[model samples]
Target: MSAEIFDICVIGGGINGCGIARDAVGRGYSVCLAEMNDLASGTSSWSTKLIHGGLRYLEHYEFRLVREALRERELLWANAPHIIRPLRFVLPHHAGLRPAWMLRLGLFLYDHLGGRKLLPPARSLDLHQDPAGKPLKADYVRAFEYSDCWVDDARLVVLNARDAADRGAAIHTRTAVTAARRDGDCWRITLQEKDTGRESEIAARLLVNAGGPWADRVLSLSDQEGGEGEEGHRIRLVQGSHIVVPRLFAHDRCYIFQNTDGRIVFAIPYEGDFTLIGTTDRDYEGDPGDAAITPEETAYLCAAVNDYFRTPVTADQIVWSYAGVRPLYDDGASAAQEATRDYVLRRDGGDGGTPALVNIFGGKLTTYRRLGEAVLDHVEDVLGARGPAWTRRAALPGGDFPVTGFDDLVARLSADHPYLVPTHARRLARLYGTAAWDLLEGGEAALGQHFGADLYAAELRHLVAREWAATGEDVLWRRTKLGLRLSEAEQNAVADAVAELRAALPNRP
Candidate 1:
């Protein structure tokens, strides 16, 4: 059968791919995005969960990258204030690790470099007297408290894909692009569903390989070999891991500690109950799809945390762990940590030229919007002028709430939904933002039964109906982190409910 042709076909559903699909579709392009696993199932979810100007990147002189990221940080925060909140990070000054004056200088540049409006500027701290100081050892009396934003990474990807779909982009989850070939001036593509082995073929005038860590594989599978000039540029995979442990500090502010090896580790507040600590840089050689935290990486993270915190953190304190492989562009850097996080775009079509495949290399979560716009610019170069860039003001799906006045919004929701528990109300506000009202439309009258721990029928039904939640894990883990709070039997009960609910739906996917 001849496949339906699209203006753009995007492979991989990570932040970059989803962002591109969302951008392209909004600009009046017929688009389709395919992902082998769930959205953000890859490196997107395993991020340090920070939307910040990489303070460490200053040492490497990546000023352009840092400035762009810092600017986008404000944009993202303004767009999704509920899920992405301003987080103050305390950086303890160690004598040998980093000179206090040098750190201060960096913070000074960071404050003035990019237009920082809503968030507070960096301030000096006295560890001996400040409450943020209590967690640190006596030697580090001086610290710098700076600002960054925390993101629900997985939700970010899903929201982008959702927005793309709403703008008429076809999204195929659990679907992998097995082959792509340039046929005449159009490209032929094949998609295989992972679960059912169902295969579908399609034609696209333009292809985008935003395949994160497996970009090279996509290039190879498509029989598109890198040749002389720009098309030959490649991506280097680097692995990073994070560990979640019992809360180590009392304050909401996160801590950035410098290690002996000149690397930095973050101890951020996680899920209202845990401290998220992370990340070692190592060249990854294994499959990106199968990356997991090793015992050595776990120990390294624990040791890095134990070095600065007053309280000791052993492996026993860890409750959850995750790892991700970053698809960075190799710039001939000697060390893994020194590799650039900036993105590079490879374009291959135009005029009387062949259809293009733009492969994105190395980008941070904070910079996806800018990356998306840059991608559209590349697409325009090949396809001629299509549409003006408008994603700057456009909210992703449900992020339409007024940015500066969230307190009033929350209070209004509380007043409106008096039956909702405070925690559940806050959870709804956090998860759905302004769309919480839409999710609770049927209200207490329609809520049939409570499964356990804030898992109600109304919410589950909303997840299934609106959020494209396919399985219990998708509902519990990705849509909301309720899995950590739910018991095994309660999880099974939700699973049973999902199955029953799915069986009854006539239009179930």
Candidate 2:
């Protein structure tokens, strides 16, 4: 085992930790981040994939959270135009449910709550005549349309981690922080790779517990006692599950449906061939890593959307389903849905003599960047080693192109490689942006062997080399959504290909 030292050691590679690592490394901090699993193998990748102010949060009276998330939405969209693009959602007004007046007011606040730039404002819609309403029931005569952005959630996390690595942060994926303890003024931590079962030790001036769903479990690793005795760790494990069905509508717009049960569901166009419906907020017990969608939850989601759409959806038709455990801050909320979406950073051991530990509890994808900024604020106060904050204006990895330049980028990509079809070129540009050229610079001939779908050997090589993608699941699921498109045999081929490439590599992270 190799022994080394660092200024900051972050334990988790989700969006929040990666975001923090990116900010820290850019600010010239010697940093190391370890993830027990693949990056975004938790709640970060399993989001509804919207970068928006939670409209429902308005009912919770969380004004501050909504505003911050709304503001961060634009910043995130601006920072990553390739994977994050503006999406418009249509909320059809049901006669008996929340009155039209309430919906209008909510839309008003949602629009003005955050500064308006880039995205268009919310507007009233005549569902009777509007194209977005074509798929809804006949009785829903009016609707409201608002703007949010769609993110390839898993890719977003990977991009942040990639940028952090680019800035010189040692990122250890599939490595678990087995134990941690305070050694005088530093934190001595033990890490074990999941596959190899090899243990290594390192010391860091600061430790960060960014375990999303397992914050409490992570805290136990350090065996540190806190003042909130009996209260225990503040994380409320809430499992949100989503089901994807065959394309429900042909429109580009998304639908946000309100249920009589005071809950809401989003039916969004997914992956060009399916409709994604989601998210029941039920209090979950047991290991979050084992969280999966239950039959009842699937029925609930299907029924939630069935109340609005003209074509009814059934459970058996689901192409894919995913459930993620939300590590919400338990603020004595009456229900799991009512729990706070905002993040809380509880700092310990930073007063004077002891080393500092920052434990992050509860955050949403929309506000991850700001959450990271806040984490750095705590780090600066404790470590006294500092640099200026600079993530807001930075374009992550290959996202340097203009926000509206997607079509142009696609055109350029196809032109660069004339052999690439329209579908292949567009997928490449969206996933890799200008970075696609790195793999395709040799044109179709240099793209190596085709592994079916839009995936090629060269692209797989790039993921392995730069993105820390090791297993087939890493490439098919997180790094790209090709799992949905590739067949069982093709998936196995991808796994075999990745294994071949990974084994050939001399250095293993």
Candidate 3:
């Protein structure tokens, strides 16, 4: 056990865990976070990659969740403009499902429910005349267009962890929390290093179980006397999967297709070359890590888009697909699609000299900041308040520039690095914002070995040194989606380069 104690120790390195660590540590709390894998390697990275209000959730009457998420869209965009941006979604009217009048009413509420400002309001579209209607079936004559935000989900999680670490929090990647025991006024945490089989211990006044899909399993590891499994806060393991294919449309706007089964699917422009589609929600079992897109899911997604698009999508067209298990707080909703997306926070102990435990369940990417603030409320209740809620207005690392200034940043980056092509500069500016300059330091010669697809040794070094990226998978997939564009030989070279870099660089904690 460490002689020094931390104020809080966070388990899991997903968006929720990283967001809580950032918020708590920013509020003067001494924090330590442990992730069993690379940051955002789990559920966080496998999202449909949108920071939206969940328009379909309105039918479930999740008004509060919708409003909260809707309000957060622009705030989060401003905080991380490099990875998040506004996306207009077109919902074409089907003949039998959701009448046009009802759609208008729902959209009106969606526009007014949250204090939407920077994002444009919902508007009706004449599909016959609008460019958005070009690829859609002729059956759809009218549609509704609404605003949501697209996000680089993995980067968002990493940026939060980066900001937290920059603010003095200890972030431990590839470290698993083996056990947590309440020891009087504090908790003793056992951590096992995955690589070297080394075991160590630390003490914290409070422990936060932000384990997304493994919340129940995490509770099983806790020495809680007489506490029911998960302490009555059972989570429903819901698997949501997405697929990537060659770009289906030429325009920038996304499509939200309504399925006959009452679920919804989104087809958005991704990586400038492919179209991103998916998100099938179904009750999941077994290990969340083992979750993958079933054939039925793939077909369902293809058909979902096929129903709306003039041309059909097929299985062979899919280039990449991923699945994630959402650990939703099970509210006994019969269908997986009907499960509540609202977050629930449950606290234990922290009274009369007892250590505290806060378990977080059921949250989405759009509401991670608010979820962190709520978690801190429980933290403050246990440890007393250290700082006021400050994340709403704060800019995440590399996101200090204006949200609308992305073009200017790209132009400046292109001008500064004459060696960089316009597309490469734009890509860097989109991924790193103002921080691209830091990555491009020492000019063109500094980029070192070219690993294809504009990936370079200097970028890999920066990821290892600053972003806690240990493997090429972390670099290619999470840090940047270069994996989609890089060929097999190029990927193998990147893996080798990352391994060599990790061996040479000082270890990060």
Cα lDDT, model 3, residue 9 = 97
TM-score-based ranking = 3, 2, 1
Stretches of candidate 3 off by over 4 Å are 225-231
TM-score of 3: 0.98
Model 2 residue runs over 4 Å out of place are 1-3, 226-232
Report residue 61 deviation for candidate 2 (angstroms). 0.8
TM-score of each: 0.96, 0.98, 0.98
Q: Please, what are the lDDT tens digits per residue for candidate 2 over residues 23-72?
A: 99998888999999999999998889999999999999999999999988
Give the whole-model CA lDDT for all candidates, comma-separated: 0.86, 0.90, 0.92
Clashing pairs in 3: none
Native-to-model Cα distance after best TM-score fit, residue 72 in candidate 2, in Å: 0.7
The TM-score of candidate 1 is 0.96
* Residue 300 C-alpha lDDT in model 2: 97
Candidate 2: what lDDT?
0.90
- Which ranking of candidates, highest lDDT first? 3, 2, 1
Is 1 or 3 the stronger prediction by TM-score?
3
Clashes of each: 0, 0, 0
Q: What TM-score would candidate 2 get against the native?
A: 0.98
Q: How much is the lDDT of residue 69 in candidate 2?
A: 94
**CA-only RMSD, every prediction:** 1.8, 1.4, 1.3
